[model samples]
Target chain A: MARTLRSALLLAPSAVLIGIFLIGLVRLIASSVLFDGQIDLHHYVDIMNRPDYIAMLGRTLRTAALTTFFCLLLGYPTAYYVARYQGNRNILLLLIIFPWLVSIVVRSYGWVVILGPRGLVNGFLMWTGMADRPLKLMYNDFGVVMGLVHVLLPFMIIAILSVLMQISRNLEEASMSLGGHPFYSFRTVLLPLSLPGILTGVTLVYLMSTGAIVTPLLLGGLGDTMIGTEIFQEVMHFFDYPKAAALATVLLVTAMAVVLPLQFLERWLSKRLTDGAPS
Target chain B: MIQTPHIPIASIVETQNLARDNTPAEPILSIDHVTKRFDGATAVSSVCIDIMQGEFVTLLGPSGCGKSTLLRMIAGFETPTHGRILMRGEDMSHRPAYDREIGLVFQNLALFPHMNVFDNVAFGLRARGRTDGLKAKVQDMLALVGLDGFDDRRTGQISGGQRQRVALARSLVTQPDVLLLDEPLSALDLKLRRQLQTELKRIQQETGITFVFVTHDQEEALSMSDRIAVMNAGRVEQFGSAVDTYHRPATEFVARFVGETNLLRGQVQAASGGRVTLKLDNVNATVTVPAGDSSLGLGTDVAISIRPEHMTLGTGTDQPIAATVLSHSFSGATITYALDSAAGRLLAQVPFQPGGGHPLPAKASVSVGWADTAVTLIPGKPGHSQSDMEN
Candidate 1:
């Protein structure tokens, strides 16, 4: 009884905060179903049939997946190097997390300066005679992805590095002694052991990218608008609370549709990898 | 003498050829003045040794004595800073670990936690691209290690002893020419360690593979190794068979490291008649030095090492050093008595047959004597008043 009381006391503040938000959400959902005091499902039906909303959902998923892929591709080597570096490892880790010291909004805007049409990359290309004119570097999917990957790559690197550091160097030595080349040893031993960390990184990046608003807004143009933008406009610009609520519900459902199965697949694959297929 | 070296076409080819006819030659692995340094600190100094084929050679020492470094150098996990390592007469000093074709059971076992017993055992064979009879080979290895039914169990699900067997089976399944063990049984309990020691010996003989084991435990080295390399401070103090290492340790470090010993600091009193008598510093006694030791000379300060078991009760023809029993304990088979003489304290191990003639208790006076051949004299620094030494 004392333990229960203590737990309840410890949880009371967060529970109260969540309760307030949940009641507000319930009210929003009720309003989403009622059209001026009469029960209706018009907003949800309209969202389902709307081609623009469906396309937005597809584009968001694609952008998130691409961002996750690029982050993993770039982060793995950096993580491996940082983890294996014998000297000054703390300095390298600090450098990996240095970008986070600045505000996220400021960092996103900083990318605008580097990736604009008159940015450093375009200037270098033209000066080096690589291009006749400035390239379309910003206000596109590329700019949005580059910015988001910059924001999220550290999550992946740190996750993988923590796991990589824990992996015994002897395992790789044993593999090499058993006639495995370096690459083969990495694939069989290091990669499989680091799967849990990879899964954590992928899930975190995927979910964060799916719900991302700042980078896409600051760097993306009209066609690159994601669900967050539409929901934002519905609430702030149009004062359409019901539509915003319904759109948020749809986005939440879509994220669950993708993330839940991925989590399950990772769990199943890890079991087979570690448990030898239950043979 | 440096033996002639031979290079097999490939380990796989050799494995196939040896399947029909099996014969091994001298010094399968040789370390010629090998040295290793880490971050400017010498981990293993210039060391030279020859490991014969099918011999169980153990590098035994305390921690940081460079035994593990020496073993790693042999296993090709480390590159020697100086000298050369040759396997079957071919220079393997700079070869990558994979090309060395030597099996290693790591100190932590290093069994793949992600792999089951079968997969772990089959790893080397598959890495070598020999999968035709891999299943049967894995099963055979598991059976040899006495873990036949544990094929499907992951490494984490097994006991420490079982993990050790898996590691052994994994290494032995590949049938490498040499198997290097880095204290593979150090993690087990005393009973399990003893059991696995016998099992390891049996497996080594059955496979006829060169075994190089590393450990700090003296008894394990004494019991398991065909030849023991007693190491101290990055140097091999002595390398010989267990009996030679025990009976005739070359240095004071080996004498103290390999087993319990009573050290007597003395000086050479006479060197004639093919016998040298050392006048002990504190006690009124003289000890005849072992024959054929050219190091001892007249008036030379020396430290004499005698195993505790070599000291016997009762006065003999030689001078009996009177000692008082300080404490004694019976360990079922033997009784160890800690005695304090006029010089210093020393230990004596005696057989414990119930109701034997000897019944000396604590604080009782006794005289202990040992044969001249039982003592080994090593060079020592002078000016110590007490003759007896204990470590």
Candidate 2:
């Protein structure tokens, strides 16, 4: 009994914090129905009927999916190179993770300077005569995606690199000695062994991008209104707490629906990839 | 040293000239004065050996003695700093492992953990782009190693002995010109190791494949090899058959490293007519080295080596060395007595004789003696004093 008490004491802080959040969420859900001293489903029905709100939600999911796909495509080779690098490994790792030390808001604003209409890329293009005028680069969906990918890429790389380091170098050598080429050896042996890292990186990138607010606010235009921006405007500008609460609950459920299936797929794929024979 | 040519049973039918005549056949693989240097320290220094076709040769030595380095160089994993490796008269010193046409069974067995037994055995065949009859070839190789029904089992799910067979089958299915085994049986238990050693010898004989095995275990080298290259300090000390290596060790390090022996320090008192007499250091006895051996010179210091089994509990015409029994260990068939004598500590092995009651107790005074012809005279003076199979 004493040991159980000690364990509970060790877990008290996190449990208390989660309990407070749960209670606040329950109250918010109750208030969403208890609008104007009457219990009704007014806010939830309003959110579902609004085409603009539904479009915003769809745009947010699309942008997050695109960012995660690009991050995976770019981050996997980068992580593989960094993990296999022999010389000055600490420097290479520090270079990859250095952007995380800066605040995400600061990093997003930095992207704003680079992706503006008269930014460095546009200036270079105009000077090289590749474009006659400055291209509209910032205040768009493309700008938002670039900013999100920049902010979230370190997480993906670090996850994959950690798993790559655990794989034995001898496995590759054994494959080559058995008459396999370098590419064939990597595809057959190294790729399957690194599946766990790849799954973790993809899931983390997807969730973080979907819930992003600051990057879209700073780098996107009026036409690229995401669900996070709408929720922010509903609570702070419109003072519609019930509508914001209902939207927040819907966003959380939708994110779980996407992420949970992905987690199950990860477990299933890892099993199949590592399973050697039918028996 | 004169080497007896190895004759594989299948080779007699294929190579009619070799079977019908007495002329020597060319070596299948030759390490011509190969040397490997890591940074500045020499790992293998000017080591030369010729592996005959269809022969089983072992590079035997203690750790850090450069046996593994030599084997890796032959496998095309490490390029020699000097000299060259020739496979059937073609220089393969610069070839990559995949292009060298040699198979290697690593010390860890290195079976692909993500592959099943069938896939592991088929890896080489597939890599070489041989898809036709791959399944049948894998089955035959598995049966050859006595793992016929384990096709679907993962490498991690198999036993150690089964893994050994898988590794062997994986390498042998490709039919490389030579097979290099880097102490593949060292990780197994004694009984399992013995069982696999017999299997390895049988496989080599049945397939008529040239096998170059590297091991630090002297007994494994002795029993499994047609020729043993006894190595020390990055050089081949002696290379000969097992009987010659045991009974006629060429160096003091080989005599000490290969088996349990008692080394006595002495100086040559007289040398004449292909014979020499050595005056022992502290035993107050003179030993006569037999005729037909003229290596010793007058006043030259030497080590006289006598195996523990050669020494018996008896007195000779020469004064019997007085000794007190320090301890005795009873192995199943033999009783090995550790003795403290005037010359230093020595060991003697005697058969248990089944119902021999109990051994002589510790501290009991006794006499130890051996025939002069039984002692091998090593030229180099002993460097370290105490000796028990380690130099």
Candidate 3:
């Protein structure tokens, strides 16, 4: 019918855009994975076999794990506090999410001043006589994780808070009325229901940590040389586009292999939990 | 945290004796001088009421009458600003809702959506450290509420009526001493509400728990309650058996609230022992009333109340009042005849079967009268009792 044609015409642009992007992505992936325009597994084998590649992969995963854990550790309490605020909770939420509106580079610089060896943390500790020598606080794995957590915690808190808001106060009241202490209610009811948010936060931190170039390049220790820095080196310093492209392609495949399934699992769990709610 | 007030032995002895008897007067919970205020507006003001064991008492009121606030206070969701609630003999005021052994079914029926029927029913038991016996208790409660085999089914898979039962069993499985239902049947269809009212009464009887229900529907309150506390504007106007509150209402508000009424405004012509004669537009009538309220004197106006069913079309030799039939509705059980009289419009219910349709057509002149005992004088113009008014 002409109506169907009109509707299809209305949807055509978005569909065309998606098709174009998909085709470009597919061609890029295929070209990188093939060697000299021939199908091969050399890139994947190189990714696994090279000591530098393996070390960078492990470091990337470790930093991502560390970032995720710290973000959640700090975020849970902040989200809970925000949720429990009886009035002006929206204003508080805006303040919490305000850092996200700021440039991540700027937030990273704020940490640069706060965590530098001769900066706030070192000065405070040394002045207090807690340390004889200034602690090497910046340009390390710890500093990198601290920066990533700062960048990623808002996402965790906002995600958790939105989900937390969906849970009824009545459930807590019902739990208490049935003789649960507040702590017990939090542990049993709140923590279980918040798993989806936690999963989202972990996945986000892990994916971002694996590809983090700027933060590691600026603040991390030389030992924390992740795959992202290598990608940068291959493209800009070495100008070996073939190997760089191949490495980037392998990294992309590896991340999808891990993150996609994890994301799917999180979605599946979320669906199962909310599956049978009566309207 | 636990501050129990000193009980006068007289009240205790009265309840103790009732506890021994088959009567429902045995005390389960007593709310004394409870009040709640929000900023400037008072929601509940110094309300005192005793809930007897195994009794079904309804706080029948209009919206914003503080009935729900009072129920919430009893449920431990609202802390009373001024007074104490005692469960049996111990203070329940400061205790959390769960610790008070009270089961409150919310107006929304707040069934845990993620849970199946079995898990929902078992939730309370698990919370109370009775998880060891949870399975048996859940099975027993589901069966008690007529949802035994439906336990494994999710809440979304059930009917509205079935969900309500699941909520009931969820609250009831904890073996609470008091079951507080807030407009529990309001969400159901008309037929379902009627059916559930009977089921609720049966459930209450079977469990023998004190049932305190809050409802704006007069019919629900009257049919389900042994005692109805008619409230308005955060205060109780009358608390008594349904029959007494309906027939011998103490205020004009009560008469109008519980059923359809014909209220006639008249000036008192004379006063005598237990009686008064009033003149309305030129017709005179005599009414019997209680003596203590002496506000009405000769020449002072008062409202006389007579239910429609009590008055009939007759040119009786005893008492004669004339009217014309204005409108009529013919239901199978009774024909409601609205008569336009000098006093105002009056509603009369004529039984269709017993009378075999002695239908009075519209615009027909008719004489309506009742026995001298049937009418009562109401004090003041009904001035809106907030307690008994429906939202």
Candidate 4:
């Protein structure tokens, strides 16, 4: 049918791109399992058994989780302000998105200039006689998390804002008319209605931070190397392709393990939220 | 007494009597000189209205006439730029919506989409922290609105009419001193609108809650309100009973907005006592109508409103004006005839008899006459010339 042909044509470009990526993924999996052209599970077993790799994975997950939490804490209020602002909302939204327009690598380096030992914050503290010495602000887990949250804050804010804009102002008024205080009305009405956006922002920031490389490599200390930096060092510095591929496979599986459950929760929550709503 | 020839002063006395019979000593809610301005443009001018307890008072006007703004001020959703709102003699103008204890059923119903009917109805009770017998009270309110078993369904799962009932039940469950409805029935179909109008009136009576409803439909206001406040251009043009508003409109805008009427331009020829005889423009006829306002001096220009039903059409010699039939239309209950007369193109509604065959043919000569008591002198210059007053 013509309809079938048109749909096929529409899907061809994205399908071809995904197919190429899938072929690369298959090669990566094969390399992870192959040692000297013989099929083996040693590489994957070696990764699972290694204490350092285990620590790296744990550190990566913890950093990602912290990044997601901080992003939500900071983004929610900003998004709420922008969504409910009485003036031109576009100006506020533009400010939120301005950082995203810059390259993430450049922005991460900008954080280095600000958070360095001799940087603006330390300089201010020292100049004000608040600190006797320059405080350790970078080359640690704290630095890596700060950078990741900065890079991902806009995503979280934008996600929450889109959903907040959809909720009618009338619902809040109705709650207030029924004897709810402003804060009570927000918690009982606005917060619950915007849950889908929160979930989306949380999942997106978590997934992106888990696989982040540049920020962790630049900002973290030598012992604070995450799974992404570990995989990068294996493949590029040591030229250990098999180990790198195995680590990548581990990272993919771990990310999926976190996201799959979240995807399910998102589905169930969306069904409950929009079950009988008018289209 | 000055010889007031044909003024029906008795009807005015009857209206006052009826108002006195039902009106309570103290009004439950009073909007005293309230004015709302948004960014320098006035939405509601200095308007005052006293709503009695257990009375259904409608703020009726066209869109942008400040009826909704006035209602919002009464509901405490919007603070008035000027003036005080008194609830039981207490100044509540500066109070928040929650502290006002006023329930408002919004134009869109504003039902919580996230909550089921039971939770939605019980929300007010829970918000007020009065959890004592909350479930039973919600159930009772639902039953009052005839939504007994629909508590389990989400707001989106129900029909539009059912959602309207849910909104009503939710607001009434809080047992607020006054309930404000902002054109809640405007979304439904005509048949459903009529059914809900009756339902809303019944609920208002059963709860004995003062209702300040805002709507733009004149007929809806006329049918559902105990007293209707006809608004225009950010001001209350007239606030009175439906019969008083319809029979004796206070302004030219009220005369035209409240119902369909033929506005005939005229000038006062003779003024005596509480009546004035106005000689109509273009037509060689003089009509004596009640001088409701004492400002009518001799030779003053005025416009008189004549309801279509009041204008009688016949071939009798006593009929004052001669006209030709322009066109006609058949509604189920009445046959409306358009007559092209020397006065202007006037509309006349006649009761349709089942046995009466057909309307007068176009271009047929006819005679038009109306009782002098039926003419209401509009207290302003005629808005348009007599020829263009077809609407």
Candidate 5:
């Protein structure tokens, strides 16, 4: 009984914080449904009926998915190299996470400076006679995705590196001594073993990209508005709290719709791969 | 000292028999003066040995004694710094581990934890693209290692001994030129280790694959290997049969390391035709032994090794030395008595008959004696004192 009391006392602070968040979420849901003291679903219906809202939701999903894909494509090799590095691996890991130490808004602005219309890439291309005009790099979907991938890449690398370090180096040597070529050994032994890390990175990067507001609002043009930007505009510009709450609820549901299946896949894959294996 | 040819006794007989019909067979693998230095510290220094086909050769030593380094050099996981390694007369000095057709069962067993028994055993075959009849080959290898019908179980689901067998089967399915075992049974308990030692020997003989095993336990080496290489300080001190190594250790280090011995400092008092009488220090005794080497001459100081079991107690007829018991230890089959004698501290192992009686009480007076043949004249003076080389 004393142990239980101690545990509850230790957990009380975080529990109270979560309770406050939950109360605020309940109030948001109530406002989205209740107007003039009569409960109605018109705000949700309004969101569903607008074609531009649907298109913005589609564009948000596409941008998030593309961000996740590019993060994984660039992060896997970098994480593998860092995990296998013999000398002072922490220095490399620190370099990867250094960008994350800066504010996400500041980093997003940094990307805008490098990828702007008269930025370093366009200046180099025009100076080298490769292009006659400056490239329209920012204020587009490309800029938003580039900024999001840059900001969220450390998550993917850290997730993959943690799992890669847990794998024994002897397994690869055993495979090689059994007449396995290096690439064949990596594919058959290392890749399948690292799937859990890949899944976690993909889930984290995709979810964070979907709800992103600062990067998308700063780097995106009129055609590249995402659901987070729409939610911000509904509340900040029009003073429509009910509509913003409804859009936020829809964003939550849509994010879950994509992530729930991914979470199930992660659990199933880990179970199939590591069930009954020694820790 | 005369170095004997590195031919096992059984193989010498086979060579004599084959010499009448054709030329004698060449060694399947030869480690030619191989040396390995890591960061300017020698790990294996000028080690050479010839391993015949299908012989179970064990590199036996304590930890940090270069036995595993020599085995790794043979397995192509490590390259020798000084000498060439010849496999069937071809110098495979710089071959990569994957290119060499040698299988190593690691000290940790190194089984694929993510793979089931069947997949783990079939991994080599699948990796080498030898997919035809892969299932049957895997099953046969598993059954050979006594892991039949355990195909679906993950490596973690099985017992430790079962995992060891899976590692063995995984290495053997490809039928490599040789199998190198790096203390694979060290993780098991005493009973399971003994059981697997016999099982490993049986499998090696059944498949007729040359096995180069590395271990630190002298008893394990004696019980399992056909020939043993006793290594110390990055050098091969002695390489011979188990009986030869146990009966006649080559150096003072081997005499102390291989088994329990009571070493006594002595000087050759008289030398006559193939026999030398040695005057022992602090014991007032003179023992005559055959002068086996040219190093034994008159007035030359030497050390003699007498195994604990060779010394007899309470013999009554020839009680040459008087002593008092220090302590006694009961080890089920034998009772080892530590004696404080005029010759210095000595150990005497006596057989224990179960339900017979209690051993001699502590501090009891005793007499110890041994035959002239039981004393082995170590070739050189003792390098390290007994306490310095205890382990």
Candidate 6:
């Protein structure tokens, strides 16, 4: 009985903080969806009817999917190489995670100078005569995906690398002894076991890319506005909290629909891959 | 004769021999003047051995003597730096392990954890490109190893002994020419090891395949092998049947290693065919030796080997050996008495009578005797034998 009290006491501070934050969020959401002494569905219906909102949502989903796909494709080779090499794993991980220490806003601003019309990329292209004029590279979908991939690829590689490292090298040798070459060994053994790790990375990249705000605000132009950037504008620019909160709720539900089932799939795959292990 | 294509067992054996001598009747596998050096330091030096087909040879030695390395070389897991490895008279010093068709059961067994027993057995068959009848063959091999109906069970779910049988089935299912077992039973307890030893011998008899087993335990090697190759310092000190190795050891190392032995340092007074007469500091004895090195002349230094069981306690003095009883131990059926003699402390095992052994009163006058045939001439200084076969 006393231990239970002590355990509850240890959890008191965190529980209190979470409770207060959740209450405030709920009130905020409630106010945005309800107004004038009557529950109104007008804001949500307007968001669905608007062409701009629909275009932004479509753009956000497509860009996030493409970004996550590229991250997995490029990250698998890097992770495999790191796991196979004998030395300097700590140094390599430190280098890859260094960007995470800097704030996302600061990272967005740094990319601004790189992908802007007169930035280093354009300057290099002009100096090398690769282009006759400054390229319209900034404020585009390409710029948005480039920045998001650079920020999120470490999660994919590190996740997959850790899983691959734990797999026994003996499995591969067994395959070879049983008449498999290196390529088929990777295909039959290493790839299947690593699927969970890859899926985990996929969900992370997709989730962060879907709801990403600051990168789009700084790097993407007016023509490339995503649903997350639109929601940010609705809350900050317009004092109409009801429409803004309604839009935020819609975005949250949309993101959850995509992320929840994929996360479930990742967990299911993880269990299947590890089930064959000798407990 | 070609109507049905049936051949008798004798003709099959004869046909195999007729094709075998295409290049010459070289050993099925030969370790020729092999020296293994690791990072410029010698691990095994100037060692050579030959294994014939269907021979149960054991690479027996203490730890770090390069017996494992020699076995690994035979498995093609290691390469000999300065010698040739000939398989069926062809040079295979640098062949990859997988191409050798030699199954190696690692000290850890190295069974695939992700595979069940049946799939594990089928691993080598699939690798060898056999598609059909693999399931039947796997079941047959499992039955041979007494693991039938364990097909779907995971390798992790079985007992240690059963896992050993599964590993055996897996390796044998490949039909490897030579099966290299590196202390396969060392992982089991004593009772299990004894049980598996008989099972392994039975399997060898049934399969008629060459089994080159590596072990540090002398008793395991001696009890299981048809021929034991006692090794030290990466070289074979002696190779012969267990009885020949124990009763007629060729080297001092072999004498000390194979069983309990009382080594008595002496100088050779006379040397002849299969016999050497030696004079020690306090006693003179004639010893018979296996025919190998007869180079030692009169006055050359040598040692006499007397096994503990060979020494008999008696009161009569017809050229009797004398020693003081230091301590004695009761071993149920037999009593092992430790005696301090001119050479050193020696152990003598005497059958315990119905009541008790004749307790030669402590520090009392006691005489010991052994026929000349019981003494073996070794080529080193005296060393005590504290080994026991009780357990």
On DockQ, the candidate that comes out on top is 1
Tens digit of lDDT per residue, candidate 3, span B140-182? 7788788879978988899999989988888877767788888
Candidate order by TM-score, decreasing, is 4, 1, 3, 5, 2, 6
Candidate 4 residue-wise lDDT at B204: 78
Candidate 1 residue spans exceeding 4 A from truth: A1-34, A37-55, A85-91, A127-129, A275-279, B1-25, B269-274, B284-286, B293-297, B315-325, B330-335, B350-358, B361-368, B379-391
Over B1-391, each residue of candidate 5 has an lDDT whose tens digit, in order, gives 0122333334533553453245236776888888999999999988888887778899999999999998888877789999999886778789877877789899998888778998888888777777777777788788889999999998888999999999999998887767899999998999999999999998887777779999999999999989988888888888888877787777788788888988878899998887888898888788777776545667888888889988888835356677899999999899999999888999999889888788988888888877677877775665842111111
Tens digits of per-residue lDDT for model 4 on A1-279?
Answer: 999999999999999999999999999999999777889999888988989889889999999999999999999999988888999999998998999889888999998899999989899999999998988898999999999999999999999999999988899999999988998787778877998899899999999999899999888888879998888899889999988999999999998888889889887866764443221
- Order of the predicted models by DockQ, top scorer first: 1, 4, 3, 5, 2, 6
True contacts kept of 3: 0.42
Which digits, one per residue and each the tens of the lDDT, describe model 1 over residues A1-279?
999999999999999999999998788778789887898999999988989898888888898999999999999999999987979999998998999999889999998889887888888998899998988887888988899999999999998888998898899999988988888788788888999888888988998998888888888877769888788888899998989988887887788898899889888987777765221
* Runs with alpha carbons beyond 4 Å of true place in candidate 6: A1-154, A161-166, A209-279, B1-26, B32-47, B69-96, B281-292, B297-301, B314-321, B353-357, B365-369, B380-391
RMSD of 3: 6.1
Docking band of candidate 4: acceptable
The residue-by-residue lDDT of candidate 6 on A1-279, one tens digit each, is: 999999999999999999998998798678766677777778878888998888888899898998898899889999988887778888888888999999988998898898887899999999999999999887889888888888889999988998889877656655554555566567656777687788778888888898888888888888779877877887788766677677667777777888888878877765554343221
Against the true structure, whose lDDT is highest? 4
By TM-score, how accurate is candidate 3? 0.83
Q: Could you give candidate 2's per-residue lDDT for residues B39-69 as a string of tens digits?
A: 8999988888887777899999999989999
Please list all clashing residue pairs in model 4, or write none if there are none.
Answer: none
TM-score of 6: 0.78
Return the TM-score for each candidate structure.
0.87, 0.80, 0.83, 0.88, 0.82, 0.78
**Per-residue C-alpha lDDT of model 4 across residues B1-391, encoded as one tens digit per residue:** 0111222324433543454466557777887888899999999888888877667899989999999888888877899999999997789999999887789899999999988898888888778877776667788888889999997898889999999999999998877878999999998999999999999988876666778889999999999999998888788888889888898877778888899988788899998878998898999888777887556878888988889989898976577778899999999999899999899899999888998877889998998878778878875576632111100
Real A-B contacts recovered, model 6: 0.21
lDDT for model 1, on a 0 to 1 scale?
0.83
Compared with the true structure, what per-residue lDDT tens digits does model 2 show for residues A171-276? Answer: 7767777777877777777887887898889889988888888899999888778888778888999998888888887887788889899889888876775654
- Compared with the true structure, the alpha-carbon lDDT of candidate 2 equals 0.82
10 residues in a row with least lDDT, candidate 3 chain A: A270-279
How many Å off is the CA of B334 in candidate 4?
3.9
Error of 4 at B355 (Å): 7.5
- Any residue pairs clashing in model 6, and if so which? A32-A242, A139-A221, A178-B127
DockQ each candidate and list the results: 0.54, 0.32, 0.36, 0.40, 0.35, 0.23
